[model samples]
Target: MTRTTTVRIAMNGVTGRMGYRQHLLRSILALRDQGGLDLGDGTVLWPEPVLLGRREHALREIAERHGLEHVSTDLDAVLADPDVDIYFDAQVTAAREEAVRKAIAAGKHVYTEKPTATGLDGALALARLAREKGVRHGVVQDKLFLPGLLKLKRLIDGGFFGRILSVRGEFGYWVFEGDWQQAQRPSWNYRAEDGGGIVVDMFPHWEYVLHELFGRVTSVQALTATHVPRRWDEHGKPYTATADDAAYGIFELDGGAVAQINSSWAVRVHRDELVEFQVDGTQGSAVAGLRECRVQHRSATPKPVWNPDLPATERFRDQWQRVPDNGEFDNGFKAQWELFLRHVYAGAPYRWDLLAGARGVQLAELGLKSAAEGRRLAVPEIAL
Candidate 1:
């Protein structure tokens, strides 16, 4: 048995929806139970998450339920502690930047959720601050670690997509109208005042996905809408929906491949998965969702004549073959957390840094800009 090295983290947002469920309960605590991650040199890494929040009772309850002994309502006091190895932020999108800046000042390694800041400049500032302070910083890019995407990556690497042509993405489901049924997402997701909108919320994910899977995003043109203007709140109170519920986007990639991504909370699912991408190339095409990936090779490709004169009889759905799951797929959040822990505990390097996070914010910002200005905007590279 190797020695377990403890990495104490001051978790500032453990009381929030994502923080408690994904980071604390699933990632950190689960890692602790699995004997932590092995550090290649007969050593193990143990994550110690100290819950910090505005609500003492909620924080205490989470700590107790999760078998953590440390809980605090005072964030500043907790961050000031020298024992805390890392400062993590999964707080509300509006409240993240200040706490992260404070963590950088305190010389702690930092990890945070996406859209590192509300604006692109603020996100870039955080990147610069981390570099100046010489601290390791990372943001959650959990989707890249998904099993379906991983399989898609394999096909791309294998030249299954010989000369990629275009990419089409469909994401979202019908979030219930609170008048009749409970909404699937939090009410804040539809409010602009609370830093919520479809473009800002979903475009960040699309940016990284397209950039990683295909190539760098050279340009973007988007159209957004606020469908279903009225909605009931958590307390059954009616409120005006201020933010956009849908975003239709076209992105020009590095290789001149055009990617069309449509994200909407108002649309009903008619595709194979809740989120799916169908990539077409000179050789073949593949569609990948969160868990499953399907492919159509050129050899197995189907051809049919289009005619409006007769009734359709082609079963287009049966043409593609299923992609195999090579191995067990762990929770994407947990997988990213493990990699982050390894990077912190050992001297291992991780490519997804604050700079990458800033790019995501840039896409969201530019997507909204394009929507408003009714023009295509170029995505200039941000040098670190």
Candidate 2:
């Protein structure tokens, strides 16, 4: 018979879309349904979640919907429980730091959504506190686990991209303005005071993706814009959108390869996916999105004549070959949760810790500062 280790997790922010769908339903509940996580030594690690939220009704509804046994409106009471081993936070950026601080003080292992705090200093402080308290700490860096990126990583590891030259990424789709149609995103995402902006929101994701796949970002030059200045809220009331809806950035990597990315909530997508990245190298080039990747080798490169007087004859997009998904890919969020759970239970090495999260926050801080100063800025390394 397998020994069972029950790990109680206190989850905050289950009312939000990301928190509800990804963290709660897709990850924790999915693990529970699968009869706990296999710990490789015949010990099954089961997660018992206690949902924590500000809205009692919403929390109760979610708990009852899922057949969960526990729900709490008071974070302090949950944290005070000696049985709770981990505190998972998926709250908005503005409220994250305080809750995480309390969790750390309570000696709970902490895992949180990115931009761990609204600013670099707060994020770094969290890292320091977590370290001082001798607790396992992590922040979600889920993009690295995506199927498309996994294929890209496989290609790079196989020497498909010999001496990689550069990477270009496009991420975004038009978020409906609330006046004519309800906005897909929350109103707080357009309010700077509420810790919302494309730069702060996305640069952290870019930072880790680039750092892990290409190289560490040495510097950044960025321009931001508030393309939709007025938007209605969930209540359908008009309010000024002070935050930037778009950001165009050029990041210089440590290996001399430059990465240019355009992030926008206002732009319409004309590509295969909502987000896509094209990597160019000496031997070959590849384009990858959330679930697929296509590659073109130097030997198969197309040559087209420039003729202003005639219609284009070349079918450029058809030339690249699709990279096959060689293995089953699990949901990115659930995969990360499983890894983090193993790390918490069996002391497995988890690299995407709070310090890595702080690096992401550092990039966002510099990106925004670069936009405001109208100049390129250096990305200094952070240490705790």
Candidate whose lDDT is highest: 2
**Cα lDDT tens digits for candidate 1, 156-217:** 99999999999999999999879889998778888999988988888888888888989999
Worst 10 residues of 2 by lDDT: 177-186
| Deviation from truth (RMSD, Å), model 2 | 0.8
Which candidate number would show the highest TM-score if scored against the true structure? Answer: 2
In model 2, state the lDDT of residue 291: 99
Model 1, residue 13: distance off in Å is: 2.1
In Å, residue 7's CA in model 2 sits off its true spot by 1.2
Quote the positional error of residue 35 for candidate 2 in Å: 0.9
lDDT of 2 by residue, 1-384 (tens): 799999999999989999999999999999999999999999998999999989999999998898999999999999999999999998888999999999999999999998998889999999999999999998899999999999999999999989999999999999998988888999999999999999989999999999999999999999999998988999989999999999999999999999999999999989999999999999999999999999999999988788899998878999999999999999999999999998988899999999999999999999999999999999988898
Q: What is the lDDT of residue 163 in candidate 1?
A: 96
Residue 119's lDDT in candidate 2:
86
